[model samples]
Target: MSILKLGALRGQLEIKEFLRQRESVVFTLAFPVILLFIFGSVFKNTIAPGVTFSQYFVAGMVASGLVNTGFQQLAIAIPMSRDLGTLKRLRGTPMSPISYFIGKAIVVTASMLFQVALLLGFGALLFGLHLPTSGILWLRFTWLILLGSACSTVLGIAFSSVPKSGRGASAVVSPIVIVLQFLSGVFFVFSDLPKWMQDIAALFPLKWLTQGMRSVFLPSDFAMKEAAHSWELGKTALILVIWLIIGTLLSIRTFKWSEE
Candidate 1:
């Protein structure tokens, strides 16, 4: 077979395998919705003196979904694939490593899209969330989703490079993801937190994504009260781009095809 055919086949196989795994689907899609229900219900009529609970929770959900798909899912799966000799087996095949990665990327992107749609649908139909007011606002939401997914996927690959074994992959990855969820303001309003805490959280992409998402969905008047106090689309785009670049470089430098 030609190299192009080989690559396409590899990607198709990867996607098929992903679909066959029920656990992955549950973890990626259901888990986030569960959290949304818990948090959304808890905060439902209890808005902060100044902020609406639904609005706050929506931002947090977007951030949580981004992390779950981009960082948490990739970190565990990639390393386990390496440890199980999947990556090793691929190295001996006719398909280029780049093609193998492209296949994984396609799978990840598809999964992320499904996760996002499911969350949005659940949030709106059952939870009373409204759609964006205009096409421009919806466009911003799209950009945030793409950028957030890219950053998390690269970071997940980078982290996978260091996991000790397939068995330990979730152990190492989940803690970071869970911790970041709390720190990323997924469960609480960051503005209500102490100043230093907010400062530290700003260093991560989660904060940018959640805040950017809020800017898109919330009223323009609300943006004026944000910490950044403005949409700052350029900053959001820049931060995600930098993280994607850094994560890509690190993964390329550190990733191994085998348990080396």
Candidate 2:
């Protein structure tokens, strides 16, 4: 079979396997909505004069959902596969590692996109969130989500090397994800965060991901509430692209077929 077709088949299998794993599905898909319900209601008051807290919060939650599925899920799954000898067996097969990685990436991208849509729908139907009206904004949003998800997935694959066993995957990866979530303004305003914390967050993709989504979904004037008082699209794109490149290289260099 052609490489393209092979990859698609592998990816389809991966997605199916992901769906069948009830624990993963629950954590990846349901956890974000729970966060939204708990925090969104508490912060139901408005951010700006016109923008309600739910409106402001949805963007960050969407970004968080992307990372949750794209990064957290993959990080754990990859290591668990390694511990289970799945990666070792795959390596012995005719299928190349590239195809397997591509399959994993496809699964992450699909899950994250679905998660983002559900969050947006909930925000819109229940909280009255407004989506971008302009086609250009939608285009930008599409590419940003694609790039952000890709970067996060690649980072997850790379970080999988850090955890030695399936049991330790959550312990190793969850703290980093949770810390980034808090620091990236996922639950709070970026500008209101301390200056040092803001600086640290700028070095990571989650902050930019949240900010980029905010640029798409929130009012343009809400940019004033951002750290630099603007969307900084160029910076956001550049940072994510850089991470993607670095992550791809790292994952390739460090990847192992087995736990030996």
Candidate 3:
């Protein structure tokens, strides 16, 4: 088969396998909604006067979905696949590593998009969130989503390179994801966070992604008022691109097709 057709088939199969896992389905679609209900209810009338709680939560929810699919899933699954000899076996086939990566990327990207849609739909129907009216706002959202996905995918591969075994994969990734969720303003408003915490969070890609997304969904007049207030789209894209490059280099240099 042609490379394009082969990659498409492999991607479809990977997506199907991911969908077959009940826990994955629940976490991807339901977990964010549950969080929305909890947070939206508790903070309903308490968020800053100009900011609607639902509108504020939508950006964070989308960020969470990106993390779940791009970082959490890939970090755990790639190592497991390697440990199970899948990567080694695939390497021996006519399928190139590039094709394998293409398939994997397609599966994860598709899954993330679905998760974003579900979060947006849930936020709209239940919490009365509305879409951004400006086309430029959507353009920013699209840029942030794609950049965040690329950054997360690379970082996931980099982390997968260090895991001693497939069994420890989730153990390592879960804490990092949880910490990021907190620091990235998914659970708390960045402006209310301690200055030190904001400084530390600024070092991570997650913060930039969350802030960039918030700029899109939040009112144009809304400003972070914290160190992260200014959303430098060019700078954000550059940082993600750097992470992507570093991750790519690390993956090439350190990744092992089979358990060592």
Candidate 4:
């Protein structure tokens, strides 16, 4: 069979496995929604003149959902597979290592997309979140989601190189995701964060992804709440692209097919 065909098959199996892990899948997708209801309900008042906290938070929740599927899941699964001899066994098969990671990435992207849809649908249905009305805005949102997913997935595989065993994956990756979420304005308003904290968070992809998503869903006038008092679309795309390149390079350099 062609490598592409083999990779596609592997990705299909990955999706099946994801479905089998019903509890994990449910938690991964539902955590953001739960937070949306909790925080969005408590901060029901407007964060800006016309935008309620729920409306303002929809983008961040979407970003968080992508991160959970892209980074957290891969970070745990990849290292666990390595320590469990799954990777070593696969290495002995006809499948190339690239095919393995490709399968992993495809599954991550698909899962993230499902999560994104859920968040947006729930937000619009229950929280009065306004989706992008213009075709151009939707186009912007599409490319941003694709770029953000690729960057986050690659970063996750790169990060998996840090943990030597499945047992340690959470220890190595959880703090990073948690810190990024907090600092990237996932649970708070970016404009309200300290300048130094904003500067630090700006160095990561989550902040830019969240900001890019906000630019798509929020009203144009809402740019006033952003750090630049604008959407910064160009900067957001550029930063995520740069991270994609960097993360791809890092994963190539560090990805392992077997425990080391």
Candidate 5:
């Protein structure tokens, strides 16, 4: 079969494997949903004149949630496959390596879409998320999700090299994701963060993703509260594009079919 078609099959298997692991399911998917409630409860007031903190925070969670499904999922999963010698065996198969990466992209994209749908549903039902009605806003939302998924998924595959073994995957990967979420304004207002934190967060794609999401879910005036005092849509798109390229290169350089 063609590599693309094989990749689709691999993606289905990946999703099934992910579902079977209750720990992975809870940590990578459910944890974000739980935090959405915890933070939403503590800061229930309006972030803007009309937008409640729950509403604003939902956008942030959506951004971070994508990171979870994309970055964190592959980061840990790939390493576990390596330590278990799964990748090594797969490498001996007739399947092309690119197909493996393609499978990963599919898994991230599918999981992220479901994740976002759940977040939006929860927000709308309980917190009144108020999704964008404008075509232009929805257009922006579409690209953000596309770019965000590609960026995070490839980066996660590259970052899978960090852990020494499957056992260490979560320990090494989780803290970094947590730190980025806090720094990238997922847990608080971007403008309200320390200047140093703001600058640091801008160095990564998560910050830009959060800002892009905010632009979609919040009013245009809410852009004033961003660190740039503007939505910076152009900048957000550029950063994610750059990172996607860097991540592709890094994954090629770092990818190993075996623990060896």
Candidate 6:
């Protein structure tokens, strides 16, 4: 079969397997939503005119949810698959490696999109969050999701090589995600963070992703309040695209079909 068709078939299989993982479904997917309620309620001060901390936190969580779905999910899944010999078996089959990635992409994209919808729904219901007021902002939001998804997926694939065994996958990957979330302003205001923390997070894509996402949900008036004192969306896109290239290269170089 053609690579595209084969990839679609693999994606279907992946969805079925993911559905069967009750813990992954309940916790992996639900953790962010849980955080939304806990953190959103505590930080109720205003960030901008008519924008509350709960609303800001909700917006940042959408970006964080994307990272969880695309990066954290794939990074853990691929390493486990390698240790379990799934990729080893695929190597002997006629399936192109690209097909496997296509399958993973379908999974993360679907999961992240659902996550965005869920977060936005709850954000509106509880925090009075609203969608972008202009078509241009909506356009920006759409691209950020797309570019962010692509960047996160490739980075996840590359990072999968870090954990030596399936048993240690979560142990190794969890801290990285947690730290990035904190430093990248997903859980706090970027400008309010220590200057050193802001500098460190600025070196990574999550910080820019959070900023881009925040700009989408919040008003332009608030851009002046950002660490950069402006959205710097052009910088965000540049950083994400750069990481996408770097991640693709790293995955190609380090990706292994088996533990060997």
Q: Over all chains combined, what TM-score does candidate 4 have?
A: 0.97
Question: Which residue window of length 10 is worst by lDDT in model 2?
Answer: 33-42
In candidate 4 the C-alpha lDDT for residue 179 amounts to: 92
Regions of candidate 3 where Cα sits further than 4 Å from its true position: 1-5, 224-228
lDDT by residue for model 4 (154-206), tens: 98898888888899998888888989989998888999999999999999999
lDDT of 1 by residue, 1-260 (tens): 66566657766887788889988878787888888788777776745344567667876787678788768877898888887897898788766766665566666777778877877888887677666879989898888888888788788878887778888989998988777767766777766767887788877888888888878756677776676678667887898899999998998888788975
Off by over 4 Å in 4: none
Cand. 6 TM to true fold: 0.97
True-structure Cα RMSD, model 1: 2.1
* Candidate 2 C-alpha lDDT tens digits along 1-111: 766778888999999998998887887887888787777778878878788878878999988887888889888888998998989999998997788888988998888
TM-score of each: 0.92, 0.98, 0.93, 0.97, 0.97, 0.97
Candidate lDDT values, in order: 0.78, 0.89, 0.81, 0.87, 0.89, 0.87
TM-score comparison, 2 vs 4, better candidate? 2
Give the 10-residue window scoring lowest on summed lDDT in candidate 5: 24-33
Off by over 4 Å in 6: none
Clashes of each: 0, 0, 0, 0, 0, 0
Which number leads on TM-score? 2
Ten consecutive residues with minimal summed lDDT in candidate 4?
96-105
* lDDT (tens digit, per residue) of candidate 3 on 1-260: 77887878888999999889989878876888888888887777646556776677788889878888888888899989988998899988998666666677788889899888888888888877767888898888888888888778777777887777889989988899999889878888877789888888878888878878878877665665535456777887888888889978886777678875
